[model samples]
Target chain A: MARPARRGGGYWVYLIPSLVLFLVVIVVPFAMNVTTSFTRWSGVGTPTWVGLGNYAKLLRDERFWASFQHNVGLIVAMAVVPTIIGLVLAAALFDYIGRRFGTRTASALRAAYYLPQVLPVAVAGVVWGWMLHPSYGAVNQIFGLKVNWLGDSDIALATVMAVMVWFQLGYPVVIFMAGLQRADPALHEAAEIDGASWWRRFWHITIPQIRPEIFVVLLTCTIAALKVFGPIFVLTRGGPGSATMVPSYFSYLNFFQKADVGYGSAIATVLALIIVVVTFLFLRLQERDS
Target chain B: MRTLRAPGGPPGRWAVLAALVVLAVVMLFPFVIVTLNAIKSPAEYSSGGPLSLPQGVYLDGIVEFWQRVDFGRKLWNSFLISGTVALAAVVLSVLNAYAIGIGRVRGRLWILVFFLVANTLPQEALVYPLYYLAKQAGLYDSTLAVIVIFTVIQAAFGTYLLSAVLGQFPREILEAAALDGAGRWRTLWRIVVPISRPTLSVLVIFFFIWTWNEFFLPLIFLISNDNQTVPVALGVLQGDKMMDATMSSASALLGIVPAVAFFLIFQRTLTRGITVGAVK
Candidate 1:
C-alpha cells in the first residue's frame, strides 16, 4: 500500500525559503533575545555581560513573583474553570439540547458563546472595562452598586479573571462540542437503556471520549493565560498599584516603558522556558494516557 | 437512533434550556450593553444611566471616534497586513509541507518538531530582538516588518498541520503523476495543491484571523499613528483619560464590527478548522 520512494536530496530546495524565514523571524531573534538576557542593556549602548544577574534579581523581585502568582490566577480563569464549565455545556448542547430543541438551537447557543473569541482581545478589554467602570459603567448602573471593578487593588485581579472567563469560555465549548460529535450515540443510548444517569453517562462516556481535546484545550489555554498581555494592557495596565500584573505585561513594561531591556529579556526567557516545559509535560501526559 | 428524553421530560428539559439561555445571555451581555450605550448621547447616558434605552440614535460619538483615530486608515492597515500574511504564510506552508510530507526529506520529523516548538515560543522571546533588528534595518514602524514576522510565525502552525495532512496523501496519486512524467513542481501545482485546496483554504482563513487579532508584536513594532492596526489603535486610545464613556463604547463597537462580520461569514469553516487543527 506504499507509494514509490522518491529521491530526497533535491527536495531540500523547497524547504530553503521556509527555513530562511524561520531563521530570520524566529530563530535569530529568539537567539538574540536569550543572549541579551545575559547582559545589561538599555536598548541603546553596548550590552555589558552580567551572567545570571537578571535572573538572580528576579528571584528577589517581589513584582516578578507577584506577576507569576497572577498567572496562576489567570490559569484558573482561562483554562481550568473554562474546561470544567465547557465540558458540561458541550454535553448539554450535544446530548440534551440537540435532541430536544434541535441542532439549530444548540449551534446558535454555541455561536453566542463563541462571539467573544472572534473579537480582538483588546476590544474585549474595552467592552469589559467600560461595563465594569466604577461610576458610569453599566454593571454599576444596573446593579446600583459603587464597587470599583478595576481601581481597587483588592478586587481588581478578580475582576480581570471574571472578564477573562468571559473571553475564554467559548474556546473549550467549541472544541469539546466538536469532539463530542465523534462519540457514538449508541453507547449513550445503551447506557441510558440500562438506567445510567445523565451524569453517569457523561462521566463514563463523554469525558473519556474527549480526553484528547481536553488535554489540547488545557494546554493551549494555559499557555494563553501565561502569555496574556493585551487584556492587561488595555484594561488595567497591571495596576491599581501592580495588583493584576502578569509576567508578559511585566516583561513588556521592562522592555518598553522602563527601558530595562536586559531584565525584560531575562523575564521573557524564563517565561518561554516555563511554557516549553508545560507543553512537554502535557504531551508526555497525553502519551502516557494513550 | 432512538430518541430518549430525560425521565421527567418537560420540567427538567425546560429548566435546562432556561439555564442555558440565561448563560448565553450573560455571555452576550457586554456586547448588548455596549451597543445600547454607543448610540446614546452623554446627556442621555448620565440622565438615564446605562440601563435606559436611548431616546434617539446618536452617531456623533462613533463619528468623533472614527475621525480621531483615523480608523479608515487603521482598517486598511489591518486588512493589508492580515491579507498579505495569509497568502504568504500559506505559500510558505505548502512549500515546506511539500518537502517534508510528499518529499519525505531527511530529518523531517525533527523539522516538524522544530516548527511545533517554534509555534509555542512566546512573542515576548522574539519581540525585543526583532524590535532592535527592525530598528537597525531601518524598517521600524513599517507594516512590512510585521507582515514578514507573522508570515513566519503563522506558517509554523500551517506547516505543522499541512505536513501531517500531506504525509497521508494517497501515494497512488503521486505515483501516477510520476508515471505520466510530471516533475516535482508540475505535480505539486497540477495535482497536489488542487487536491489539498480545502486544507490550504483553512490555513489561509486561520492565518488571516490570527494575524488580525495579534497584539503584542504589532503593538511594539507599529508604533506610529498611521501604521497601527485596529486592535492597537483602539487599545492605545483606551488609556487616554480624555475618552468619554460614549466614545469608548463607540470605539469598542467599531472594533467589534469587522470581527463579528468575519465570524458570521466564516463560522462553519472556522469551527471545522478548529476541530481539525486541534485533534490532529
Candidate 2:
C-alpha cells in the first residue's frame, strides 16, 4: 500500500473557507474603496469618474491638513510619551517593586494601571466627557476652576492628548514588564555587584533586553494613534472647530455626515497609505537593528 | 528562584512603592469618580456638586438609562455578535494556520505576510466599501453584518499569530497522526486543534473583547436601535446629548462593568497571552 501525499494540494482545502471570507470581507471591499476614491458619488447613484478630483480637493483641504497634523500630536501622546513613562513605570514595578516588595504587590499595581484599558474607548470618552464638562465637571469641581477642557480649541487638543496618555500608559507597561521576565537575572546581579547605578542598569540591561517589546509597542501604539476614532466620535466628534480632527474621523465625516463617499474614500486611502509606509519603515528599521 | 535585591535600601524602596501607589490611584481615579457619581441623584448632584458625596444611594439613574436605551437588548446584541465572531474567527484561524503552518503550503511565507499586512490595514480604508456592500447585500442594520465583518478582521490577526505558533508544532505528532491513517480534517480536529487549544482560547478572548468594544463599523452597520451593540448604543446616545450627567455616568458604569468583569476573569490568561503575542 502506498502512503497518500499529505502536504500539497490537500492542505489548500482547509484554507478554502478562510480564503473566501477574506476575499469578500477584506480584499474586495478594500479594492472597491480604492477604486471609489477616483469617482464622485453621494453613495446612492452611480459614481462618476473624476480622475484625480478628490485627491486634488484633499490637497487644498485645510481640514485634511489639520487632521494629519492632529494625528502627529496624537502620536506623541499615544506612543512617545507613554512609551517613555511606561518604561520607567515597568522598570520600577519589575525591578524595584517586584524584587523588593513582592510580585503580588507589583502585579496589583499593574492591574490598577491596566484598568482603564479594559473600558470601551467610547465609554472612556463618556467618562471623561462627564468629568471634563465645562461647568459641572469633576476636574473643575476638584480644582475650583471654570476652564472649558473640551470647548476651547487651543486647549481641546491638549485635553484629548492628556486623556490619551492616561488611556495608553498601561499597554507599554504591561508589554515591557512581560518582556523583562525573560531577561537574564544573572546579568542584573552581576551589574548590581559591580556597583552599576539603577539608572545605568536600566539604560543598559533593561532597555536592550526588551528592545523587541519596545519596538512592538511603539509600532502598534503609533498605528492605533493613527486609527483612533471611537473616542473622537464620542468626546468631540472632531469638534470645537475641528480641533481634535484626525484622519479616520475626517474620513468618517465625509462618508456618513456629508455623504461625500468618494472624498471619504480618498482620505481613507491616503491614511491607509501612510500607515503602510510607516509600518514598512518601522519593520525595516527593526530588521536593520537586529 | 530567589528574588534579586536592588541596591536601594528599604527606605528608598518604600518611596518608590509610594510613588507607584500614587500613580496607580491616579490611573484609577476616573473609575473611582464615575462609580461615586453614578449612584447620586441628579438633585443631589446639582446641589452638592460633582465632588460631594451622595446622602443616599440612587438607582433611578441606572434604571432609567437602562430602560431608555433598552440596554438589555444592546447587551444581547453585543454578546451575540462578539461571541459568534470569536468562535468563528478561531475556527477560521485554525484552518488557515493548519494549511500554512503545518502543511507548509506553497508560497506560505507570502501568504503569511499578506495576512500580516491585512491585519494592519486600517478599518477606515475598508469601512465605506463595507458599508456600501452591506447595504447592497441587505445586511445593513443587522448584527450579522457586524459579526461577519469582525470575524474576518479578527481572524487576520489570529491567523498571523497562530501560523507562527503552529509552524513550530511537533512534527512527530503530526507524522504519527498521518501514519495512523487520520485524514487531514480528522488530524486537525484530533491532533492540531487539541494541542493548540490554549492559543485558540486566547484568540477567542481577544476577538470577543475587541468585537465587543468595536464602534465605527458597528455604528455604521447597525443603524437600527434593535441591532446596536453596547458601545454603539451608548455612543449614539452620548452624541445626541440626551443623557444627563448622572444618566451618562450610569451608562458609563454599565459599559465598564462587562469589560472589567471579562478582564478580571481572564487576567491571568490575558497577561500570559500578551507575552505570547509579543514574544512571538
Per-residue lDDT of A1-290 in model 1, one digit per residue for the tens?
A: 12344568778999999888899999999999999999999999999999999999999999999999999999999999999999999999999999888999999999999899999998899788888878778899899999999999999999999999999999999999999998788899899889999999999999999999999999999999999999999999999999999999999999999999999999999999999999999999999999
lDDT of candidate model 1 versus the reference: 0.93
Structure candidate 1, residue pairs in collision: none
CAPRI verdict on model 2?
medium
Best by TM-score: 1
**Poorly placed runs, candidate 1 (over 4 Å):** A1-6, B1-8
Residues B140-206, candidate 2: write the lDDT tens digits.
Answer: 8887888888998899899889989999999999888878898788888998999988889999999
What's the lDDT for all of these models? 0.93, 0.89
Question: In candidate 1, how many Å is residue B47 off?
Answer: 0.9
> Which residue pairs does candidate 2 place in steric collision?
none
- lDDT (tens digit, per residue) of candidate 1 on B1-280: 3344445466778999999999999999898889999999999998998878999899999999999999999999999999999999999999999999989999999999999999999999999999999999999999999999999999999999999999999989988888888888899999999999999998899999999999989999998999999999998888467888898889999989999999889988899998998899
Judge candidate 1 at residue B100 and give its lDDT. Answer: 94
For model 1 chain A, the run of ten residues with the poorest summed lDDT: A1-10
